[model samples]
Target: MLTNVAVLALDGGHAFELGVFCEIFGMDRSDDGLPPYDFALVSATGTLVSTRHGFRVEATHGLDRLEAADLIGVPASDPDVPQPPQLYEALRAAVARGARVLSICSGAFVLGEAGLLDGRRCTTHWRYAAELARRYPRTRVEPDHLYVDEDPVITGAGTAAGIDTCLHLVRKLQGSAVANDIARRMVTSPHRQGSQTQYVRRPDPGRRSGSLTPVLAWLDAHLHQPLTVDQMSRRAHMSPRTFARRFQQEVGTTPLQWLTGQRILLAQQYLENSEEPVTAIAVRTGFGSAETLRHHFFRRLGTTPHAYRRAFRADPAPPGR
Candidate 1:
């Protein structure tokens, strides 16, 4: 039922993060048979909000707009700056009334200030994760995720991941068909599970040797085959010990961890787009059995494979144009 949307335009907000909210919720897409949201940009500080990118945006609405919103989007702003007390009060009121609040990147800090993130699991951009955790010790901070949906408060990782976070709320509240159609209009992937890693490792420019790109590309093609660190190490021309170290440094995760994530992603595609039984999909995605698939699905995605399929299976397209 999440039809009404309001985004907070805080002073010094990051332009791209604010744009993510506007792009996902503000546009009129009823022509595509999608539900249109009553959307507005509410200036949390003042009518003229200045972005960190050296531009000012005039928000026609103010904090009063948030009163009627089903979803309130808090885009990234200066985490160090203290938000107005009234802004935080409005947020708590909205959540208390059963509305949802979503934050992109450092916007999670604002939620932390409002006491919304207290005792809740949340995430933010990797670069700011440590600070967020340090600032709000009551909340458990998961640094690696693209987003975390702890019901009333949703937190997204860095810039592009904001799109994933917003679409997820839409999918959860509406349906995957609607989320996917919006994503198609936006020219982006329809669904990236919140459990997916942020992939924050940056390549060391000083060391140009022994990139694992070839092995990773090979692994993608051979996911159906049982894979082992030793086997992959041989393909990368390194010993198991060296390969494992390099993979962790370059990929921000162990090879086995990365492999499991990739397999789960492949299984998700099968469940959504195909009518194959769970056992078949498990084998196809290298989970080997439906039981194993369900275990990983629940652990990583917080749902059973059958439930995921029921929620996300694509709807049949109408015959006539």
Candidate 2:
């Protein structure tokens, strides 16, 4: 149903993210059985718009493009200077008519200003999540993961994550085979779960110490074994008290949280890529049991492992693929 798409570009446009949208959605992949999107860029005016990095884009269509669109994408831009009232009106009109909307990175600010994010579950770059939450109280802003696709409304983190979000929409509207083919051609991952942590912790003092790297790598390699924070501290040759502070600083999250996230990622891989039973997958992923895996999977992905696999799997990825 969402075969037509309109990408709205404004002043201070993030060219990389905008280009990601075009590359993933605008390119024709008809031979692969993928749905072709009538995708094009629309500006506030049918004129040239300047990007944050000093490049300019010439748009032939204005907000008028939204009229024929079944989906609309808004790429990141500087949030301080907002778009004009007419642009807001046009977006509101499109959503009112049931157009699915998506925002990449700071573009969430524009959607927020337009009131489209009101009472919606959305996410932006982790760096901007706090500010976005401050400005939009009605919206539940999640800072982690790659993206959030809440059916008709979707949002993503900064940079390459936009490509992931767009590919995901392609997957949703089209299907896994089509999405996977497009991704393969583009040299990108077709489906990186939205719940994966943003990245390894940074600026943490504990991990930076020469002693901790090997321990961390070892932990990564042996995740299926019961991992304890105390054991980790000893492995790093540090007192638990010092290790906790260092881990939080270096990773941007607590140790247990990071461990839990890693386990979840492993569990998800088995859920999608293998035919392992839930309990067996849980044990292999170090969650101990299916129930433990389910709790964390739901907390992180907003769905049970079984449900997620069933919805997104191309081949039935239950045990024994």
Candidate 3:
């Protein structure tokens, strides 16, 4: 029942993904009608930690917590410092004792370092996927997909995918309803991606002083409305032609495609978080119709909203299962 989940935090760990696990399990999700998880942050030292970003975090638990965990989470961390030997031994021992190990972003390196990923399938952030593969030649690393679960050991693709992976685990254990309930409370999606087609239009950003930060923020806030290159151009004070050319060049994606992805992301969030039904989520996310929402959600996430939610909720039986 996921009675205990231990998240390992070390020097230079990214707080956001660490916070992701806390959001899903560490917090009181029961207020949202979800199950409660016993969650704690553990470290090699059982003391306060400083991230690569300069924030300080204290974890009172030590490596002993790994022995009692149903799941062990490894969030993003700096690849510079290697994981301690004792920590690696603790991880190996935990998995040997049947505890599931999860890694987010560059945290894949931690699993690799522990020899847990040898001859197994895994993944990490796209930016460091090549390095992960190069470093762990015995492991097969998938560069796409939001997350890959090798049953006992799972790895998320990047920062946001960490949330998706955590929710996916909840879906696997509790049922779709519970996962959706927690996701809604967190304001995130139940399912984000499938088969890597949605990620095909990945655009590399331009490194000039003119950034798309403002435009991206605007798009995120106004995803419910119809957005065009011309409209976005006007908002950014650039001509339509210039904006289109530069957006494609800088963002490594078309404005339209990015907007569609954002809309899907929003729809996914609503589907997981709210019980208002697919039609309602469609309208709220600007999909216009249930049919449209169905098309995109299935195409992007490889499952329908109903099916996805059902698998992760209180219902133990999946469609085929």
Candidate achieving the largest lDDT: 1
Clash counts for the predictions, in order: 0, 6, 10
Task: Report lDDT (Cα) of residue 206, candidate 1.
Answer: 43
lDDT of all predictions: 0.88, 0.81, 0.82
lDDT of 3 at 196: 38
* TM-score of each candidate structure, all chains considered together: 0.65, 0.65, 0.64
lDDT of 2 by residue, 210-262 (tens): 54566667777788999888988888788998888878777678888988887
lDDT of 1 at 37: 93
Tens digit per residue, CA lDDT, model 1, 191-305: 7643434143423334433588878878888989999999999999999999999999997899999898888888878878888899999999998999998988778766678
Pairs of residues at least 3 apart in sequence or in different chains that clash in candidate 2:
201-251, 203-250, 204-249, 204-250, 275-319, 275-320
Which sections of candidate 3 miss by over 4 Å?
A: 195-321
Please provide, for model 3 over 81-101, each residue's C-alpha lDDT reduced to its tens digit, 9 standing for 90 to 100: 897799999999999999999
Q: Give the candidates in order of TM-score, highest first.
A: 2, 1, 3
Which residue ranges in model 1 land beyond 4 Å of their true spot?
Answer: 193-198, 202-321
